[model samples]
Target: MTDSSAPADPRPRSALPLLVAILALIVAGGALWVSYGNATKLAASKEHAAVAPPSDPAIEQIKETLSSLQQAVRGIQADQQRQAERVGDVQQGISIGCDPTEGLSTTGRAKVALGSTERAQHAG
Candidate 1:
């Protein structure tokens, strides 16, 4: 048996395997980091694509058509308003009769009275 009191041998331990393992871990970590970055980029691109407006010409044309239809509807509504105003003016002047003391002559009043009498007779 060797004597326990002898000074321990001073030979340095081989650090090669430990260094290699640490290097491998670092390389693996770097690879994982790169993969994560790439995944993030891909996800962002997908999200952007999902939110992006339509690029198709047909879709654009449909949008334009809808806008034109809305403008046409507004135009039609304006036309209806003008026609309604004209009808109101005509009704006020002729059917309901305007101020009798103004432009209307006696013969016109007699005719209006006859027309009203006829309408009342028809209703009853």
Candidate 2:
């Protein structure tokens, strides 16, 4: 008599369809992830291009203004030096009765005033 309680084929043909379906799902999911990732990168690059301003014109304007200010400062310094030299010459030549302390105080006060005005103008 045949033994009826024997096990069926361990490699069941029924498993093939299940495996194909799982593979298809995995492929679809991967395709979606790649598309979304590319689209996100494209969007970020577009936004960056839109927001960043060109630097050339702004840089040139800054350089021009700096040059003008530097020229003005040099001119003023030359004038101040000339005036100080004249004062020194007068101090050496004129031995008048004017208090030496008063002359020095006046010179110091003038220098302080000039410096403050220059600073205030630059701060503006």
lDDT of each: 0.81, 0.80
After superposition, the stretches of candidate 2 with alpha carbons farther than 4 Å from their true spots are: 11-52, 55-59, 96-124
Which prediction has the highest lDDT against the true structure?
Answer: 1
lDDT of 2 by residue, 21-42 (tens): 9999999999999999999999
lDDT of 1 at 115: 77
Please identify model 1 stretches exceeding 4 Å from their true place.
1-4, 10-54, 99-124
Per-residue CA lDDT of candidate 1, range 89-123, in tens? 64677666664324446875686578779999999
Each prediction's total of clashing residue pairs, residues at least 3 apart in sequence or on different chains, is: 0, 0
What TM-score fits each model? 0.47, 0.39
Q: What is the lDDT of residue 43 in candidate 1?
A: 100
RMSD of each: 7.7, 12.4
